[model samples]
Target: MTLQQRQLAADTPTRFARALAVTISLGCAALASMLLAEAAARDGFSGWDGIRAVLVFVTTAWLAWGASLALIGLFGGRTTALRPDLHAPQPRTVIAVPICNEDPLTTFARIAAIDRSVARADVTADFVVLSDTRDDGLAGKEQFAFARLLRETDGAGRIFYRRRRDNSGRKAGNIEEFIRTSGGAYELAVILDADSLMEGDTVRAMIARMQSDPQLGLLQTLPKIIGARSFFGRALQFASWFHGPIFTRGLARMQGPTGPFWGHNAIIRVQAFAESCALPELSGPPPLGGHILSHDYVEAALLARAGWKVEVDETLGGSFEEGPENVLSFARRERRWCQGNLQHSRLIFAPGLAGWSRFVFLQNVTAYVVSLLWAAFLVTSAISTLYAPPPEYFPGPYQLFPVFPDTSTREITLLALGVLGLLVVPKMLILLHAILLDRARDFGRSLRMALSVLTEIILTTLLAPLMLLYHSRAVVQVLSGQDGGWPANQRNEGQLSLCDGWAAGYWIVLVGAAIIAAVQWLAPDLTIWLLPVAVPMLFAPFLIAWTSLPLNRVLFAVPEDAAPLDVVTEYDSICDVWRLTWNDEHLMPKATSPDLTHATA
Candidate 1:
């Protein structure tokens, strides 16, 4: 074998060894946490309930997630059996790309690209640029301009545009209107996010799968991040590309026909959606009422509740979307998600919900609760530093009597390890999958990839305390009836700001600093336990911004196939052409109708 091949082989084992070492360490920590909980229980520690609850939640999540993987391995291995072949002669389908207040030109370009891509595969699908932009002046003009441009482009014949005069449920309303007015003509409807793209083959596969499985109401693909242009964005893209498949596979295994709908990059059986997926107006006040902020989960639940299947096809590759560009954008997106998940608490307790629906709701609630717990754990650690009892400098009479009190430091350390294991093991497992499946090539050299993973973990470890802080704060804000207004995120490429950092990252830093000071003053010998929390806190702002950078651009560079736009130049050219053609044979002047003459007479 050549030296390069030999070096590659040698490198593989080293990488695998590192992965194995981390995996073993995490597993040992998980086990130790369980044993500590059991020991604490036997000792009748009054505060063990909280520790036990955390351990139980952690262990249950781990096991439940594992069981999900096993189920997918057993049942989902044959998932292709469930998908239909769209290559056969099939009825015409309509692909709807929904847009609200967005960059209309970008939105139209994406729709055009998707249309062209699908057409290249010889897939005859109608394209609908569904706009829910209200009849407000600016948005209305943009929509009209978009419609005119689309008609002048290749989409003139096959593409259609519809703008709602009254925007009701936003996206859900927009989709419902299309169904009510024009859905009857299509066999299926594939929904695409304004920023999403699907390769022609993947789209064909989805349609084929739907055709084969008449029982399948929705087939959603895992979307890869493709256009991130910052450090954080690159990390997110790498992490998503590496870890997303495992979680998705696990989720799909457990979900069956009750999987989630992320509101985009999925195909739906039109009749089934119309019949079963109508979203109800959520009751109560702001944040939880009027319209569902998270209509996707609820819609999926409603579909499953109505006996229609909703499944995620993790194998459907080449589907892509953009991630939030920075920390502020991430928080804005997460805040809305938090409110939506919290609102699920009501539905969780509501009677008559299916078992899987309840499970789905519980999953969403647990996500928010877990964020709060991480924050709580940080607080508890800090308090323990300040309030915990010192070691016995002298042996007590009880020592002579043969009974010994347990060490609080050991217990706290074990608890900390347990939390770390829960967070880190999943990533290690994903990395293992990457190596074993020969997918590490996409991440650069094995050494660099390993370094990247280590860097990501270290960076993420530091940011965890901060994320907990922001998410907990957001959760509290929502619960207290505060509104997180809809603001367009800052997409400018830039460094972290002190104000933005404090808004999203202050909690971890403050908490970590407090812990360190308390440890120095109260428990000098136990300061070692603060390392995990301290590193992240010290570099909270940089780490927060760096990890949240638009990473997609680095991982998946823009393809040569992408279309570029010069907005000002294009508009001028379009205006000149329209003016010259105003009196042409195929054109009719505005306000020159028979009704005008009748009114004048």
Candidate 2:
């Protein structure tokens, strides 16, 4: 009695509710954009002022739109629960764990934990370690780790491993090869990243949803960050735990059946994926052309085009993934994603795509393109100040002497408040919602959660200028025909040396210094406004190094960090055993050292 054999009613959000949510979202964006344009044109509009105003309005409105959705979700009640037939036997699902040159020991331990979890729930599934490693040394290490994981779990036939010879299209190609070669044996394919870990119940629930809704081509789970070490990673973890749910719920409601696939922690109907998702090489060279770097979004669009429902179920919990420990690693990952997103401009008008799908593509591209707009705004502002003609109030035919340009401080202040409200109000709403729902305990209680949110706001505010510069440079490089080749993710990229940090962020510091000098020399009034962004750019290296350390964990301890999940605890215990098993002294041991196991326990 596989899950496909079960028949259950699928309940979706009412079309009116979905439409109203979108209307609120777009309405907020339109209001903010108008306010921003008025603010930009306050000091008498000029030719260059038009561009700055348009850019500010678009970027501000875009952000406000997201914040509006989150605010709406906070008041929209708990997520809609979709009942599934859990009593039916689980279907034959393949757990595809894709990897490259990641830490094999950690990867294998995560796999073992997931395997044990599914077995505990008595789900019928198989685990596959699909490696796209081009390096022979890393490939050997992966195999050794995989063998140890198999032995420890007593998994011989249930788990398998395969490394590709020519890592042609990277992860997308790897999965495609598997789908063509081995995906036929299973009805559902649960795609996972090297760092993904899902609880047995989470996996079963996702499968049941797909089975209940035969029209569902893909089901995505919201993966929370777990097992963070550094202050940066922990802060990100806390923020995601606290605020991610509200935004995700809003997004889910808006998406309806046409949702996003984040490349992992998602299950796809094998037959549908094979039929709709054979990505063709874009007709050009590299960077903005060539093979698609970001394939997940395109796949979702194709599936929707082929009449399959792709949804994100934010209500489902226990799906987890690890995040980068420092800013440098995060920037590196963002660079690749930035290039992939820009490539979508060519496919935006692909034939037969849904309107929402096209909007999604536009949104994805804007995620990175906004950086360029910010940089342009800053440059044009400075130029406008440096080369401005003195305000001449007396007209040619007027008899009066010189009259000063009138400044509307109250109107400007009101516009500033509007922007600030859009930025900060949603977080406050989410906080109130959490308190009302008695869910503050999950984030270290009300007081601690409030403190954490404040800290996150401060840290992100300080880091925004540094990120702006980094993203702007990435966009420029990609536009100039540069391809950021697929690089393996380093799971435990620990620290940022001062030199490395300076090398990565020196340009931002220089630009910040130059801007401060220009503003103070030409436009003294704007110097106060520039300090917030400039100071952070000047100290980016120190901030990066400081946040990469494990210091101040007690100050910002999230609920998960304060006390980890049971599966995390079990994974840690398993990792300790494997660590000793890989040690030279215990090289020949068939079983893990008793003392080591007892020590972890």
Candidate 3:
């Protein structure tokens, strides 16, 4: 370890914090495994039961690790601040917004709003639209929009737009190209997605932090979901508003120097990034080979390897991004992410990566793998029951697999309940913590926040099976060598008709029906027990359509709306005026974003 990292490690509580989190996770996993193994060993402990026990450990460990992070944040108290929250930005910072097959009007208006924000703050920052758009028709629209945007924002030299005809490397490549060509002019770069938005103050804050610490290579801010209108969208917004911070805080405490970079809504030292974050194509073919899929995580690891501090600051607000308004869009994005993460398996042994960075890759892979493991466990459970032998009432002392004297039903019920508790308890605690700390009033008082939490929990619970199926499919596709290519995200009007939902989810329905039919004939007794898992799948199409519909803001009114950020309000006003103009000219479709409409109202 370098002297700087050693000092930071010694000064910070990252070691103790990580150790505690892991110990808690492992302890819970081991206990749950023993209980599950005892419960499954009812008729006879077969090789299948042993295999299940191992799977249970891995799956439970993943769940418990997540819960532990939140628990740590709840009790861990005050995380250390590495930067002094500097306010003055010394040199010009380029705001690089990477785009590919996106809405030009909505995209350019954002640039206008952000330009106004920086101009208002009197901070020296430039906006660069690094376009990787492929469609010729859309490329022309981008030109028109860029011209109009320049006129609207009076951005002659301050704002720039460029589209690459040869879009080879995608988003990462887009950013890298800019750095290679125009990066020398700027000292700092604030990278953002096409949908990402940030307040002038927040940009100043991140720049100040970077300026304050020369060793800081990258600074990531927690980008909250904004402008979500649909039911699924609002639920996500609430979860991010209510639950995201706690988890983010926990992660922030542990990620001392080698913290994460989530691609966008972050600031990076141009020199450091240019020198350290260049990625090489991995040897071999597609899926697990070729170009790195999730380049942000790899870049963070590389920066750390180069002896630069990479940190995430969740406390900084005014950073925001739009999300897919429906489950289909969300799943499509998740599928791409799954492939990206699984592709990292090849880099686990890549030399010079920090231990945590290596573990981060494993964590990503296991996240999807746990769903598969759960699927495997269920299948194994059914087989073990089918081939049951006479119960071993008299087992040897100090047996490797315990044979319980009591009814296995009770043990199994307890184990199941424990797993559910692990999934739920942390969220309930976060809500309680919010109330106790007087933070719940921000979301229209404790009562409404309570309702939001309950409603979100119930909704997420119903949707869990569908999401599990989606993730399982993603893992299978990646493993079977199917590349989930860069799919364009659906950012606006996320509603899905029943037909559309059905078209997307018919296979899920079929899979659910198949499981139920298989179990009804083979294991008649367990048929009722499996309804919770199967019923959701059967109704997934309807659920998807339902959740995609818009919801009243009364229920999920965000704290951000309570006191609007400068950038958010600016963007909304610009959107309202632009929509008015577009609708008048009959050149664009109407229906301004709900978040924008609500804020403007």
- Candidate 3 lDDT, tens digit per residue, 53-126? 99889888988999988987788735555445545436779999988767777888888888888777667898
Give the TM-score ranking, best first: 3, 2, 1
* Whole-model lDDT values for every prediction: 0.64, 0.77, 0.82
Compared with the true structure, the alpha-carbon lDDT of candidate 2 equals 0.77
When sorted by lDDT, best at the front, the candidate numbers are: 3, 2, 1
The predicted structure with the larger TM-score, 1 or 3, is: 3
Give, for candidate 2, the lowest lDDT window spanning 10 residues: 592-601
| lDDT of residue 448 for candidate 3 | 88
Writing each residue's lDDT as its tens digit, candidate 2 over 63-139 gives: 77677568656765345589596556666799998887666777889999988888876787899988876667667
List model 1 lDDT by residue over 1-601, tens digit each. 4332232121333234324433544565466556556544443534534554464455445433443353343334333534455656776788898776554444555665566567667788888877665435436555555665576565666788777878787778889989999989988988887677777777888888888877778888998775566666666666666667766775665565577898889999898899877777878786766677677888787766666778888888768776765666676778878887888887886554456678678777777766666556445544443443444545665455444556555665665666566566666666665677766666664565666677677766666666766788888998899877444343333456666666666666776687788777775755776666676776676666655544433333222113322322233354456556544323321333221110000
Q: Best candidate, lDDT-wise?
A: 3
What's the true lDDT of residue 41 in model 2? Answer: 57
